[model samples]
Target: MIQTSPKTFRLHIGIFGRRNAGKSSILNTITGQNVSIVSDIAGTTTDPVEKPMELLPLGPVQFIDTAGMDDEGSLGLQRLERSRQVFDRTDLALLVASSNIWTEFEAKLLEEIHNRKIPVIVVLNKTDISPPDPEIVKSLREANYTVIPVSTLSGEGICELCQAIIESAPDSFVNRPVILSDLVGPGESAVLVVPIDKEAPKGRLILPQVQSIRDLLDNECISIVTGLSNLPQILSRSGFQPKLVVTDSQAFKEVAQITPPLVPITSFSILFARFQGDLQTMALGALTIDNLKPGDRVLIAEACSHHPVEDDIGTVKIPRWLTKKIGGSPQFTFTRGHDIPDDLSGFKLVIHCGACMWNRRTMLSRIERCLRAAVPITNYGLAIAHSLGILERSLSPFPGLLNTLKTTRSV
Candidate 1:
């Protein structure tokens, strides 16, 4: 029997360094297992390796061992690119240097890590052979970088490294937000409206729905799940009033019609818009749709790759709605899963999915990328509501966001 947490729920720690710097060895020691193929040969770990384990006190963590930044040739460049991609999603970064060597490569890595504003710990490995340079250590310390010397051969300093990681973890991870529980109090009831459509998974709910139900249960809130057809009956039944109602965004219109005005109604995507990324930025991005021209390029990003049906949401439905709103179809570019383009300059606006399959770190990373490129990015739920002319009503749960929408509209 295996007990494993969802990858998205774990803290992502990326181990990065030049080739043969014992990056994989550090991962092996920390995980107590050979999570990566450690070899004296350079560039042996061609791709990023992931290890999910429970790091005590820090809770669940996913360690990613990436290829060396100093890799050579065409293949090496690709590997380096992949490693950089991993860095974009890392919550905490471990920069491994061995045998007292700290060069421009390490400095550049430090610059990149610091630019991302990610917490980092510098590990000086192979201390048995040669300890870290005293001058280099002093300089790094003066710059406020935590330096820990460890030897994989002797298992030295591994404990300190783990402790450093726990201390360096973002405060958001240590105190996670309750998915749906915060909305409905303990003993209160929540009604989930799930539409069983062609896109629905066979015999299983999507990740967001499952997680929401589990969160309600964990928060001691009662949850009642119903399909779109049965939602009216469940809501109108005698002597039962749910504290809140959450529906899939695709069924927002029907659910809104069926749900009464007094009940607070929201969508799973809306919840995730706040949970995984910056809700305020996404809400503002929703207003950008009015500025989209017919030929303006729009990027539609989805976190999970799935086969598209005739009426797919990302490619078909959303595009259809946007065309009607903008008076013509914008150049729709679709990117599935984690392959968010590095260059967002060509796009006028980006409409992203709820990102239930992604962690908060990854979602924020994408949002940061969009911000850097000066591209407006909004999630599916907000985009849908804005196009449907009910964005203000749908965002009623968050009064601040509603005010933001009003201010932006007035401007």
Candidate 2:
């Protein structure tokens, strides 16, 4: 049986260009599939279309084909806004333009891509009809951009475009960080506490749990998966000791009690705080919880959308916890999936999910946005641990972080 890699693990390559500029054609040609609707009519793609495939040598990649940035009118503006959001998650960008056309649309798009500091490959499409203007190509090349001339109609330069994508991928994707492998060394054992609950999928474990187990195995470490009921038994086993203990954020209190003090403890969400976003920044953000006042606006953001359970972590539990911590009710706003608010400045604090469904780029982008808006941002795990008054204990795995937290608290 073959298993497909999750979208979160794939490099996000966004294809940006104007209407009817053969953006869809370029995507279809590259993936060898009709991934997006191809039509001569402008604005054919009203929403971003994503295709995930193995771009070998570079491994898994997600290609996002977006609507034209040059879209007009009210409805067109909405589509354009959606396309702009793609910049937040794009690890690499492919700027597609017709060989003969150089307009404000392309210039603005390129400027936005540069502002995000995303590596780009300029694809001058329709080269078979008219070779890319020498002056335009020279200007792009002089700007240190990798320019690839292609004709989707004739398949010319497709191989070169593919090669350029491989070469331009972000270094972080190439040298991906381990989720928890570093915490548990080879030949060492780590306990994973996963409580099977209503929110848990019908049969399979959640993405973060599955990925955690895989990470340990990949590094030749032993992973012992269990529930809260059996955690004590696993820990009490004669002559058996694990290097670390990881649990769901909801079960942190119980798992912390069951595990030995010598063993490091953390949660999947907290691990992802470091894996997907800036850990130190978030740790500091969690510190701001003490300063939250009643009625302060807080944004709880989840990367995936699902029906809220009675004790939904985001909508229900976390809010209850925060209210209890603050001794009063605070105004809470929730956002799911890619529906990030246009203005984050209104919020006093932003509590994000583990972001198991999103790439690191998207998570980091949100963090950067919060920083720029002067709103402290933290993940579910860090916030929960801090609220429970065991954040320092949970952070014991990283001694340096513990010291940093101590110094910050002292100050």
Candidate 3:
């Protein structure tokens, strides 16, 4: 990884507080730059501002300065909502309070952070004006929170705040889960079938494909890359037998046809289903496709926003296949990028993309969001496999997921 990495690959630390609580100042101090505008007027920083930098021992980390949690008015509500959404991806939170002031807003923010199970460090800013109340500090300490008093004007206690964040970051951030190493051992061979279509980038593979190849190489395995047209010949005439064969989800049907039944074959999306999010839950959620009613609503979500071409997968193909299979034209809603709605009230099911652009924490957060809304969420690969009648075969790599689906659903 380079010094300037993607935001999804960085550890996200969110600075949250009420209006004029020196949240922006703390961010500027920590980053040693004016990343966010500092002003005396309340609600100066409306939307969340992000600053990405390299933090020692923790690698890349992005600090997010959010709007006041106590903003009031029509537009204020929207800003507040956006601020709260930051919790979805936050690895660590800094609750900024100043003048020894702690109100319902602060308490509510702390409760929300604790509810999300994110580690938090309470920051008492502007201690030069009014020092932290001993009683309040004691109460916070009793709750097992590390409270630090800092004056951004004088740059005091910034080191302590950074140290707290470094210590509190989750271990999973450093030690990430393997994409396919656990399945393919050292010295083993795996063939990757990448279909070069118009949708494919010129002279380059997609992120999932690149990451899969890199993972195999990192595990000391032999990776063979070939296009879909040559997959049959490769499988038939190659002197080497691969431990697994991975392909793009869109070509699952074709790959399944050519590959032998004994060879364990899967898609890039299926690999990500285990890498980024819950595999079994998503596999079980795929069962809901069979139970869709006439007027059911399905949400199609993608992580990256790209120009839509004719017969787009998320917009056109999946919906057409689903509607034809269900014998009804179900209402479909589309969302792309980071604009995931917090309220998933009326949606019966959510079909999400592979989320290769996002980190494990963000993907899990989206899954939890759907679960909280009492909605079943499945990814593109699982849904595609289920639609093509190869759901069981595609999920064969995972030992118990197919059996779980069998016991739960009639299929």
Candidate 4:
């Protein structure tokens, strides 16, 4: 049976532009909260600020306030890099600009957004200052874009802009991927293989396990929780064949061998990838492991900060696993939290954690960055499934993705 959380399907609208373009002001006016740091000085908001709130008619949407794109000094370059990073997962790109219209910077940004196939919403902020330039409107329209004129101070055109954002966002996102709850029949069973390793938090299963169980229950599925060692026996003795078996990536090898070929076996990482991102694109990245060389550096990136145990998967276990499977020892580097390194060129492979805390746009944006740098990126689950002998077996749950990966690897 399939299970999913409601929050999984929300429109991720990102507000990006030059420094002090009233991005924060627009966010504050929309959410009616002190969400972004409002300051007259340029570059006050150096990091990406995200706020999740209900937009009328649009429902639950995330407003990501990004740093200035035009700030000049070395610090500005870093901020600009981060702002550019937001474009990858932006369902709707709101290019906040003044009445001056699409400057050279905005034009360049628009080109990048369109090149990635992301929809754009040119928000002409501070309309109260002066009428918007017709040339800017014409330029965007010529490129088949949508533009909305608005002023945060006077609230003029704000309503129209919000409505336009919903209209301009990707047509399919309005329904939000038909959450997993929409997939399975009622009263089915799903077996979850959670390995309780030393790195497994002291008393609690990780967020993915807890959330998956809750989602399955909500979707009217009976979820059986067991560790890797006992999974085979449980499935063997079960009264009915499980509809699905979701295992942690760490046990992909053992779990694959134990699971019958007929059963639809997949890893929590793959499911999470489906739950959180583009499955085919991420799966293709997993093939990068085949090309890894001994001296190449691979970045192991995670979203949360924890007191890592001796057997921490990101630090020790993953490195060991990669070396064992690939037959070469790539220099492994680790990074935690939202800040990705400024320069990613050194790393040939970027293995990211399941970003439960981050919005989809952010994680997808990271994947976009890796692709731009000509590096391959994969998630923990996908990588583990690939390294294990059962990658093809695990992908049985996702037919479309399985076909895509088969095609990509063949290419």
User: In TM-score terms, which candidate is top?
Assistant: 2
Taking the tens digit of each residue's C-alpha lDDT, what string does model 4 give over 1-411?
844323345577888888888999999998888999898898889888978777767677777899988878888887777777667557888888887756688888778777877888888888898889888888777867788888988999888888887788676566444223333446887888998877777788877787778777877878889988788688789566887888888888788789888788887777767666667767877888888878789999997788888878789888887887888889988999867787898888899888766656667777777878888888888887777656678778778778887887788
**TM-score on alpha carbons, each prediction:** 0.95, 0.98, 0.94, 0.82
Residue 180 lDDT in candidate 4: 39
| Candidate closest to the true structure, highest lDDT | 2
Global lDDT scores for all candidate models: 0.90, 0.93, 0.88, 0.79
Clash count in backbone of candidate 4: 0
Please tell me which model should have the higher lDDT, number 3 or number 4.
3
Which residue pairs show backbone clashes in model 1?
none
TM-score, candidate 4, is 0.82
lDDT of 3 by residue, 318-363 (tens): 8877887788878999999888666897998999998987767788
Tens-place lDDT per residue, model 1, 140-242, is: 9999999999999999899999999999998888888877788898999999988999889899999899999999999899999999999988989998889
Model 3 stretches astray by more than 4 angstroms: 1-3, 340-343
Which model is ahead, 1 or 4, in terms of lDDT?
1
lDDT of 2 by residue, 174-285 (tens): 9999999999999999999999988888989999999999999999999999988999988999999889999999999888888888888999999999999988999999
Displacement of the residue 41 alpha carbon in candidate 2, Å: 1.4
